[model samples]
Target: MGNLSVGKADSIPTRPKRPLKPILSDAKNVPRRRIGKSHKGRIALLHAIAHIELNAIDLAWDLIARFSNPSLPNDFYSDWLEVAVDEARHFTLVSKRLSELNTAYGDFAAHDGLWEAAIDTKDNLVSRLAIIPLVMEARGLDVTPGMISKFRAVKDYRSADILDIIYSEEIKHVKVGYSWFMFACASMGLEPKNTWQECLKKFYKGNLKPPFNIKARNLADLPQSWYI
Candidate 1:
Protein backbone atom coordinates (compact mmCIF):
# COMPACT_ATOMS: atom_id res chain seq x y z
CA MET A 1 0.00 0.00 0.00
CA GLY A 2 1.03 3.60 -0.47
CA ASN A 3 1.20 4.23 3.28
CA LEU A 4 3.15 1.13 4.21
CA SER A 5 6.06 1.64 6.59
CA VAL A 6 8.56 -0.91 7.81
CA GLY A 7 9.53 0.65 11.09
CA LYS A 8 11.18 -1.36 13.85
CA ALA A 9 7.84 -1.97 15.54
CA ASP A 10 5.93 -2.71 12.34
CA SER A 11 4.88 -6.25 11.56
CA ILE A 12 5.82 -7.80 8.26
CA PRO A 13 2.82 -8.43 6.06
CA THR A 14 2.22 -11.74 4.30
CA ARG A 15 1.91 -9.86 1.09
CA PRO A 16 1.07 -6.40 -0.15
CA LYS A 17 -2.68 -5.97 -0.43
CA ARG A 18 -2.36 -3.28 -3.07
CA PRO A 19 0.18 -1.54 -5.28
CA LEU A 20 2.83 0.52 -3.51
CA LYS A 21 4.24 3.58 -5.19
CA PRO A 22 6.97 5.97 -4.08
CA ILE A 23 7.22 9.58 -5.13
CA LEU A 24 10.42 10.27 -7.05
CA SER A 25 11.55 11.75 -10.31
CA ASP A 26 12.68 9.57 -13.23
CA ALA A 27 16.41 8.88 -13.50
CA LYS A 28 16.90 11.13 -16.49
CA ASN A 29 15.14 14.03 -14.78
CA VAL A 30 17.29 13.87 -11.63
CA PRO A 31 20.18 16.27 -11.59
CA ARG A 32 23.72 14.93 -11.80
CA ARG A 33 26.58 16.40 -9.75
CA ARG A 34 30.31 16.15 -10.19
CA ILE A 35 31.62 15.09 -6.80
CA GLY A 36 34.44 17.58 -6.57
CA LYS A 37 36.35 19.01 -3.60
CA SER A 38 33.72 21.71 -3.09
CA HIS A 39 31.41 21.53 -0.10
CA LYS A 40 28.31 21.52 -2.31
CA GLY A 41 29.65 18.64 -4.34
CA ARG A 42 30.23 16.57 -1.20
CA ILE A 43 26.70 17.41 -0.06
CA ALA A 44 25.35 16.24 -3.38
CA LEU A 45 27.32 12.99 -3.17
CA LEU A 46 26.19 12.18 0.35
CA HIS A 47 22.63 13.14 -0.47
CA ALA A 48 22.57 10.73 -3.39
CA ILE A 49 23.98 7.86 -1.25
CA ALA A 50 21.42 8.60 1.46
CA HIS A 51 18.64 8.37 -1.08
CA ILE A 52 20.00 4.98 -2.21
CA GLU A 53 20.28 3.67 1.35
CA LEU A 54 16.69 4.78 2.02
CA ASN A 55 15.51 2.91 -1.06
CA ALA A 56 17.54 -0.13 0.01
CA ILE A 57 15.65 -0.18 3.29
CA ASP A 58 12.35 -0.28 1.46
CA LEU A 59 13.64 -2.87 -0.99
CA ALA A 60 14.65 -5.32 1.73
CA TRP A 61 11.22 -5.08 3.32
CA ASP A 62 9.45 -5.29 -0.01
CA LEU A 63 11.30 -8.47 -0.86
CA ILE A 64 10.09 -10.09 2.34
CA ALA A 65 6.50 -8.88 2.01
CA ARG A 66 5.95 -9.27 -1.72
CA PHE A 67 7.35 -12.78 -1.92
CA SER A 68 6.34 -14.39 1.35
CA ASN A 69 5.99 -18.14 0.96
CA PRO A 70 5.55 -20.76 3.63
CA SER A 71 7.50 -23.33 1.65
CA LEU A 72 10.72 -21.38 1.92
CA PRO A 73 13.03 -21.90 4.87
CA ASN A 74 13.04 -19.42 7.76
CA ASP A 75 16.65 -18.54 6.97
CA PHE A 76 15.41 -16.65 3.92
CA TYR A 77 13.35 -14.27 6.02
CA SER A 78 16.14 -13.89 8.53
CA ASP A 79 18.65 -13.00 5.83
CA TRP A 80 16.51 -10.28 4.33
CA LEU A 81 15.59 -8.93 7.76
CA GLU A 82 19.28 -8.56 8.51
CA VAL A 83 19.70 -6.83 5.17
CA ALA A 84 16.87 -4.43 6.03
CA VAL A 85 18.56 -3.57 9.30
CA ASP A 86 21.87 -2.96 7.55
CA GLU A 87 20.18 -0.70 5.02
CA ALA A 88 18.49 1.27 7.79
CA ARG A 89 21.83 1.72 9.51
CA HIS A 90 23.41 2.81 6.26
CA PHE A 91 20.65 5.35 5.73
CA THR A 92 21.02 6.70 9.25
CA LEU A 93 24.76 7.11 8.87
CA VAL A 94 24.41 8.84 5.52
CA SER A 95 21.69 11.09 6.90
CA LYS A 96 23.93 12.07 9.77
CA ARG A 97 26.71 12.90 7.35
CA LEU A 98 24.30 14.96 5.28
CA SER A 99 23.13 16.82 8.39
CA GLU A 100 26.74 17.60 9.26
CA LEU A 101 27.05 19.12 5.80
CA ASN A 102 24.02 21.34 6.47
CA THR A 103 21.80 19.35 4.10
CA ALA A 104 19.34 16.45 4.22
CA TYR A 105 18.06 13.46 2.24
CA GLY A 106 15.20 15.20 0.46
CA ASP A 107 17.11 18.42 -0.17
CA PHE A 108 17.69 17.29 -3.76
CA ALA A 109 15.68 15.34 -6.29
CA ALA A 110 16.39 11.57 -6.40
CA HIS A 111 15.62 9.02 -9.06
CA ASP A 112 13.61 5.86 -8.36
CA GLY A 113 15.84 3.61 -10.44
CA LEU A 114 16.32 1.04 -7.65
CA TRP A 115 12.62 0.62 -7.00
CA GLU A 116 11.95 0.47 -10.70
CA ALA A 117 14.14 -2.64 -10.85
CA ALA A 118 12.06 -4.08 -8.01
CA ILE A 119 8.89 -3.45 -9.97
CA ASP A 120 10.33 -5.13 -13.03
CA THR A 121 10.84 -8.38 -11.13
CA LYS A 122 8.04 -8.19 -8.57
CA ASP A 123 6.32 -11.34 -9.78
CA ASN A 124 9.46 -13.50 -9.85
CA LEU A 125 11.80 -13.89 -6.92
CA VAL A 126 14.52 -15.33 -9.13
CA SER A 127 14.60 -12.29 -11.33
CA ARG A 128 14.41 -10.00 -8.33
CA LEU A 129 17.47 -11.66 -6.82
CA ALA A 130 19.34 -11.57 -10.07
CA ILE A 131 18.73 -7.93 -10.86
CA ILE A 132 18.78 -6.36 -7.41
CA PRO A 133 21.78 -8.08 -5.86
CA LEU A 134 23.80 -9.51 -8.71
CA VAL A 135 23.48 -6.54 -11.00
CA MET A 136 22.72 -3.56 -8.79
CA GLU A 137 24.32 -4.28 -5.42
CA ALA A 138 27.25 -6.00 -7.06
CA ARG A 139 27.72 -2.79 -8.98
CA GLY A 140 27.98 -1.05 -5.63
CA LEU A 141 30.96 -3.25 -4.77
CA ASP A 142 32.52 -2.04 -7.99
CA VAL A 143 32.06 1.67 -7.43
CA THR A 144 32.06 2.17 -3.65
CA PRO A 145 35.84 1.95 -3.38
CA GLY A 146 36.16 4.86 -5.75
CA MET A 147 33.63 6.79 -3.73
CA ILE A 148 35.61 6.09 -0.56
CA SER A 149 38.76 7.26 -2.26
CA LYS A 150 37.03 10.41 -3.43
CA PHE A 151 36.04 11.31 0.12
CA ARG A 152 39.49 10.48 1.49
CA ALA A 153 41.09 12.59 -1.23
CA VAL A 154 39.05 15.55 0.02
CA LYS A 155 40.12 14.66 3.59
CA ASP A 156 36.51 13.96 4.51
CA TYR A 157 37.55 11.02 6.64
CA ARG A 158 34.23 10.92 8.45
CA SER A 159 32.22 10.33 5.31
CA ALA A 160 34.84 7.90 4.03
CA ASP A 161 34.59 5.89 7.25
CA ILE A 162 30.83 5.67 6.88
CA LEU A 163 31.26 4.39 3.35
CA ASP A 164 33.79 1.86 4.59
CA ILE A 165 31.20 0.34 6.85
CA ILE A 166 28.65 0.19 4.04
CA TYR A 167 31.10 -1.37 1.64
CA SER A 168 31.92 -4.23 4.00
CA GLU A 169 28.34 -5.00 4.89
CA GLU A 170 27.09 -4.87 1.32
CA ILE A 171 29.20 -7.92 0.49
CA LYS A 172 27.23 -9.96 2.97
CA HIS A 173 23.97 -8.68 1.51
CA VAL A 174 25.00 -9.76 -1.96
CA LYS A 175 26.02 -13.16 -0.60
CA VAL A 176 22.58 -13.58 0.89
CA GLY A 177 20.99 -12.79 -2.43
CA TYR A 178 23.35 -15.07 -4.32
CA SER A 179 22.74 -17.96 -1.97
CA TRP A 180 18.97 -17.66 -2.18
CA PHE A 181 18.93 -17.14 -5.89
CA MET A 182 20.84 -20.37 -6.31
CA PHE A 183 18.35 -22.03 -3.98
CA ALA A 184 15.44 -20.84 -6.06
CA CYS A 185 17.04 -22.00 -9.25
CA ALA A 186 17.66 -25.44 -7.78
CA SER A 187 14.07 -25.68 -6.57
CA MET A 188 12.84 -24.94 -10.05
CA GLY A 189 15.17 -27.50 -11.67
CA LEU A 190 16.96 -24.75 -13.57
CA GLU A 191 20.65 -24.20 -14.12
CA PRO A 192 21.85 -21.37 -11.92
CA LYS A 193 24.19 -19.59 -14.30
CA ASN A 194 21.95 -19.89 -17.36
CA THR A 195 18.84 -18.94 -15.43
CA TRP A 196 20.56 -15.86 -14.01
CA GLN A 197 21.66 -14.85 -17.48
CA GLU A 198 18.14 -15.37 -18.78
CA CYS A 199 16.69 -13.26 -16.00
CA LEU A 200 19.05 -10.41 -16.82
CA LYS A 201 18.19 -10.52 -20.49
CA LYS A 202 14.47 -10.67 -19.82
CA PHE A 203 13.99 -8.28 -16.94
CA TYR A 204 16.99 -5.96 -16.81
CA LYS A 205 17.46 -3.13 -19.28
CA GLY A 206 20.97 -2.02 -18.41
CA ASN A 207 24.35 -3.49 -19.14
CA LEU A 208 26.72 -4.81 -16.45
CA LYS A 209 29.33 -2.08 -16.49
CA PRO A 210 32.91 -3.17 -16.04
CA PRO A 211 35.93 -2.76 -14.34
CA PHE A 212 34.14 -4.97 -11.86
CA ASN A 213 35.28 -5.62 -8.29
CA ILE A 214 36.21 -9.21 -8.92
CA LYS A 215 37.87 -9.75 -5.55
CA ALA A 216 35.00 -8.38 -3.52
CA ARG A 217 32.44 -10.12 -5.72
CA ASN A 218 34.32 -13.40 -5.33
CA LEU A 219 34.30 -12.92 -1.59
CA ALA A 220 30.53 -12.63 -1.91
CA ASP A 221 30.52 -15.88 -3.98
CA LEU A 222 29.56 -14.12 -7.18
CA PRO A 223 32.10 -15.30 -9.68
CA GLN A 224 33.05 -13.24 -12.74
CA SER A 225 32.20 -16.22 -14.93
CA TRP A 226 28.53 -15.53 -14.28
CA TYR A 227 28.47 -11.91 -15.37
CA ILE A 228 31.61 -11.47 -17.48
Candidate 2:
Protein backbone atom coordinates (compact mmCIF):
# COMPACT_ATOMS: atom_id res chain seq x y z
CA MET A 1 0.00 0.00 0.00
CA GLY A 2 1.11 3.59 -0.61
CA ASN A 3 1.71 6.09 2.16
CA LEU A 4 -1.41 7.05 4.08
CA SER A 5 -0.20 10.50 5.11
CA VAL A 6 -2.39 13.22 3.60
CA GLY A 7 0.47 15.72 3.94
CA LYS A 8 2.33 13.92 1.14
CA ALA A 9 -0.66 13.68 -1.16
CA ASP A 10 0.62 16.32 -3.55
CA SER A 11 4.11 14.86 -3.68
CA ILE A 12 2.96 11.40 -4.65
CA PRO A 13 3.10 10.50 -8.34
CA THR A 14 -0.12 10.43 -10.32
CA ARG A 15 0.37 6.85 -11.57
CA PRO A 16 2.71 4.77 -9.49
CA LYS A 17 4.34 1.59 -10.71
CA ARG A 18 2.16 -1.48 -10.58
CA PRO A 19 3.12 -4.30 -8.20
CA LEU A 20 4.87 -7.21 -9.91
CA LYS A 21 3.92 -10.07 -7.62
CA PRO A 22 0.62 -11.49 -8.83
CA ILE A 23 0.51 -12.00 -12.58
CA LEU A 24 -2.33 -10.13 -14.27
CA SER A 25 -4.65 -11.56 -16.88
CA ASP A 26 -7.77 -10.54 -18.80
CA ALA A 27 -11.06 -11.01 -16.97
CA LYS A 28 -12.20 -13.54 -19.52
CA ASN A 29 -9.01 -15.49 -19.16
CA VAL A 30 -9.12 -15.60 -15.37
CA PRO A 31 -10.75 -18.85 -14.34
CA ARG A 32 -13.94 -18.59 -12.32
CA ARG A 33 -14.27 -20.86 -9.30
CA ARG A 34 -17.32 -21.29 -7.21
CA ILE A 35 -16.85 -20.44 -3.54
CA GLY A 36 -17.92 -23.84 -2.38
CA LYS A 37 -17.08 -25.35 0.99
CA SER A 38 -13.72 -26.60 -0.25
CA HIS A 39 -10.65 -24.95 1.24
CA LYS A 40 -9.13 -24.29 -2.14
CA GLY A 41 -12.34 -22.60 -3.28
CA ARG A 42 -12.26 -20.37 -0.22
CA ILE A 43 -8.67 -19.46 -0.95
CA ALA A 44 -9.54 -18.42 -4.47
CA LEU A 45 -12.42 -16.26 -3.28
CA LEU A 46 -10.38 -14.54 -0.59
CA HIS A 47 -7.52 -14.03 -2.99
CA ALA A 48 -9.75 -12.27 -5.46
CA ILE A 49 -11.08 -9.95 -2.75
CA ALA A 50 -7.53 -9.27 -1.57
CA HIS A 51 -6.63 -8.27 -5.09
CA ILE A 52 -9.56 -5.83 -5.16
CA GLU A 53 -8.55 -4.31 -1.83
CA LEU A 54 -4.97 -3.95 -3.03
CA ASN A 55 -6.12 -2.10 -6.11
CA ALA A 56 -8.44 -0.01 -3.98
CA ILE A 57 -5.47 1.13 -1.89
CA ASP A 58 -3.73 2.26 -5.03
CA LEU A 59 -6.87 3.93 -6.38
CA ALA A 60 -7.45 6.03 -3.29
CA TRP A 61 -3.91 7.40 -3.21
CA ASP A 62 -3.97 7.98 -6.94
CA LEU A 63 -7.16 10.00 -6.62
CA ILE A 64 -5.58 12.25 -4.00
CA ALA A 65 -2.37 12.76 -5.97
CA ARG A 66 -3.83 13.07 -9.45
CA PHE A 67 -6.73 15.38 -8.65
CA SER A 68 -5.60 17.50 -5.70
CA ASN A 69 -6.86 21.03 -6.35
CA PRO A 70 -6.59 24.27 -4.41
CA SER A 71 -10.33 24.70 -4.59
CA LEU A 72 -11.12 21.37 -2.97
CA PRO A 73 -11.22 21.20 0.80
CA ASN A 74 -8.79 19.42 3.09
CA ASP A 75 -11.58 17.03 3.97
CA PHE A 76 -11.25 15.57 0.50
CA TYR A 77 -7.69 14.56 1.13
CA SER A 78 -8.47 13.22 4.60
CA ASP A 79 -11.45 11.25 3.30
CA TRP A 80 -9.47 9.45 0.63
CA LEU A 81 -6.58 8.94 3.03
CA GLU A 82 -9.01 7.23 5.37
CA VAL A 83 -10.19 5.07 2.50
CA ALA A 84 -6.61 4.14 1.70
CA VAL A 85 -6.07 3.07 5.29
CA ASP A 86 -9.23 0.99 5.28
CA GLU A 87 -8.27 -0.72 2.05
CA ALA A 88 -4.79 -1.45 3.35
CA ARG A 89 -6.28 -2.99 6.46
CA HIS A 90 -8.70 -5.05 4.44
CA PHE A 91 -5.93 -6.37 2.21
CA THR A 92 -3.80 -7.23 5.23
CA LEU A 93 -6.64 -9.10 6.86
CA VAL A 94 -7.43 -11.09 3.76
CA SER A 95 -3.79 -11.83 3.16
CA LYS A 96 -3.52 -13.13 6.69
CA ARG A 97 -6.52 -15.35 6.09
CA LEU A 98 -4.91 -16.62 2.93
CA SER A 99 -1.76 -17.33 4.90
CA GLU A 100 -3.78 -19.33 7.39
CA LEU A 101 -5.06 -21.32 4.46
CA ASN A 102 -1.47 -22.15 3.45
CA THR A 103 -1.48 -19.72 0.53
CA ALA A 104 -0.85 -16.06 -0.26
CA TYR A 105 -2.18 -13.37 -2.60
CA GLY A 106 0.27 -13.83 -5.46
CA ASP A 107 -0.33 -17.60 -5.41
CA PHE A 108 -3.14 -17.08 -7.90
CA ALA A 109 -3.62 -14.88 -10.93
CA ALA A 110 -5.96 -11.89 -10.76
CA HIS A 111 -7.80 -9.83 -13.34
CA ASP A 112 -7.09 -6.11 -13.79
CA GLY A 113 -10.72 -5.04 -14.30
CA LEU A 114 -10.79 -2.82 -11.20
CA TRP A 115 -7.88 -0.62 -12.26
CA GLU A 116 -9.37 -0.25 -15.73
CA ALA A 117 -11.91 2.20 -14.28
CA ALA A 118 -9.07 4.36 -12.99
CA ILE A 119 -7.37 4.32 -16.39
CA ASP A 120 -10.59 5.25 -18.16
CA THR A 121 -11.36 8.21 -15.87
CA LYS A 122 -7.85 9.53 -15.34
CA ASP A 123 -8.56 12.95 -16.86
CA ASN A 124 -11.79 13.88 -15.04
CA LEU A 125 -12.26 14.01 -11.28
CA VAL A 126 -16.03 13.87 -11.51
CA SER A 127 -15.88 10.93 -13.87
CA ARG A 128 -13.37 9.20 -11.61
CA LEU A 129 -15.61 9.59 -8.56
CA ALA A 130 -18.68 8.60 -10.55
CA ILE A 131 -17.13 5.38 -11.78
CA ILE A 132 -14.85 4.16 -8.98
CA PRO A 133 -16.66 4.65 -5.68
CA LEU A 134 -20.22 5.27 -6.85
CA VAL A 135 -20.37 2.55 -9.48
CA MET A 136 -17.60 0.08 -8.68
CA GLU A 137 -17.50 0.16 -4.89
CA ALA A 138 -21.26 0.56 -4.64
CA ARG A 139 -21.56 -2.70 -6.48
CA GLY A 140 -19.69 -4.25 -3.53
CA LEU A 141 -22.48 -3.19 -1.20
CA ASP A 142 -24.90 -4.95 -3.49
CA VAL A 143 -23.11 -8.26 -3.62
CA THR A 144 -21.32 -8.58 -0.27
CA PRO A 145 -24.30 -9.79 1.71
CA GLY A 146 -24.68 -12.84 -0.44
CA MET A 147 -20.98 -13.52 -0.13
CA ILE A 148 -21.11 -13.20 3.63
CA SER A 149 -24.01 -15.58 3.77
CA LYS A 150 -22.15 -18.06 1.64
CA PHE A 151 -19.21 -18.06 4.00
CA ARG A 152 -21.51 -18.34 6.97
CA ALA A 153 -23.42 -21.18 5.41
CA VAL A 154 -20.17 -23.01 4.90
CA LYS A 155 -19.27 -22.47 8.57
CA ASP A 156 -16.44 -20.13 7.71
CA TYR A 157 -17.27 -17.59 10.36
CA ARG A 158 -13.91 -15.90 10.20
CA SER A 159 -14.23 -14.99 6.54
CA ALA A 160 -17.88 -14.07 7.01
CA ASP A 161 -16.99 -11.75 9.88
CA ILE A 162 -14.28 -10.09 7.86
CA LEU A 163 -16.68 -9.56 4.99
CA ASP A 164 -19.24 -8.17 7.41
CA ILE A 165 -16.73 -5.51 8.47
CA ILE A 166 -15.98 -4.72 4.86
CA TYR A 167 -19.69 -4.52 4.01
CA SER A 168 -20.38 -2.05 6.81
CA GLU A 169 -17.37 0.16 6.13
CA GLU A 170 -17.94 0.07 2.39
CA ILE A 171 -21.21 1.96 2.88
CA LYS A 172 -19.18 4.86 4.23
CA HIS A 173 -16.78 4.59 1.32
CA VAL A 174 -19.60 4.86 -1.18
CA LYS A 175 -21.03 7.79 0.74
CA VAL A 176 -17.68 9.54 0.53
CA GLY A 177 -17.76 9.04 -3.21
CA TYR A 178 -21.30 10.36 -3.49
CA SER A 179 -20.54 13.40 -1.37
CA TRP A 180 -17.42 14.26 -3.36
CA PHE A 181 -19.10 13.64 -6.66
CA MET A 182 -21.88 16.02 -5.73
CA PHE A 183 -19.36 18.57 -4.56
CA ALA A 184 -17.49 18.34 -7.84
CA CYS A 185 -20.73 18.67 -9.80
CA ALA A 186 -21.62 21.83 -7.88
CA SER A 187 -18.15 23.25 -8.40
CA MET A 188 -18.26 22.59 -12.14
CA GLY A 189 -21.91 23.62 -12.58
CA LEU A 190 -22.91 20.18 -13.85
CA GLU A 191 -25.98 18.18 -12.95
CA PRO A 192 -24.94 15.28 -10.72
CA LYS A 193 -27.28 12.63 -12.09
CA ASN A 194 -26.75 13.54 -15.72
CA THR A 195 -22.97 13.72 -15.33
CA TRP A 196 -22.90 10.37 -13.55
CA GLN A 197 -24.98 8.78 -16.26
CA GLU A 198 -22.75 10.22 -18.93
CA CYS A 199 -19.60 8.97 -17.21
CA LEU A 200 -21.04 5.48 -16.90
CA LYS A 201 -22.02 5.52 -20.53
CA LYS A 202 -18.62 6.67 -21.72
CA PHE A 203 -16.31 4.90 -19.27
CA TYR A 204 -18.00 1.80 -17.87
CA LYS A 205 -18.20 -1.18 -20.15
CA GLY A 206 -20.57 -3.38 -18.18
CA ASN A 207 -24.27 -3.14 -17.40
CA LEU A 208 -25.63 -2.30 -13.94
CA LYS A 209 -26.65 -5.78 -12.89
CA PRO A 210 -29.73 -6.00 -10.74
CA PRO A 211 -30.47 -7.50 -7.30
CA PHE A 212 -29.09 -4.28 -5.84
CA ASN A 213 -28.81 -3.83 -2.09
CA ILE A 214 -31.12 -0.83 -1.95
CA LYS A 215 -30.95 -0.69 1.84
CA ALA A 216 -27.19 -0.41 1.83
CA ARG A 217 -27.21 2.05 -1.00
CA ASN A 218 -29.74 4.12 0.89
CA LEU A 219 -27.49 4.07 3.94
CA ALA A 220 -24.77 5.46 1.73
CA ASP A 221 -27.13 8.23 0.55
CA LEU A 222 -26.94 6.94 -2.98
CA PRO A 223 -30.39 7.35 -4.44
CA GLN A 224 -31.87 4.44 -6.35
CA SER A 225 -33.04 6.84 -9.05
CA TRP A 226 -29.45 7.46 -10.05
CA TYR A 227 -28.84 3.81 -10.88
CA ILE A 228 -32.27 2.23 -11.41
What is each predicted model's overall lDDT from 0 to 1? 0.84, 0.88
> What's the TM-score of every candidate structure?
0.89, 0.93
Best by lDDT: 2
Whole-model lDDT for model 2 versus the true structure?
Answer: 0.88
Tens digits of per-residue lDDT, candidate 2, 1-228, equal: 244333434355545576676788876655464677789778888989999999999999899888877677888988999999999999999999989889998888898888877888888899999999999999999999999999999999999999999899999999999999999999999999999999999999979999999999999999899999
Candidate 2: segments with Cα more than 4 A from true spot: 1-15
Cand. 2 TM to true fold: 0.93
Q: lDDT at 151 for candidate 2?
A: 94
Top-scoring candidate (TM-score): 2
Candidate 1 at residue 158, lDDT?
A: 96
Question: What would the per-residue lDDT of candidate 1 be over residues 110-171, giving only the tens digit for each residue?
Answer: 77778778888887889999999988999999999998998899899999999999999999
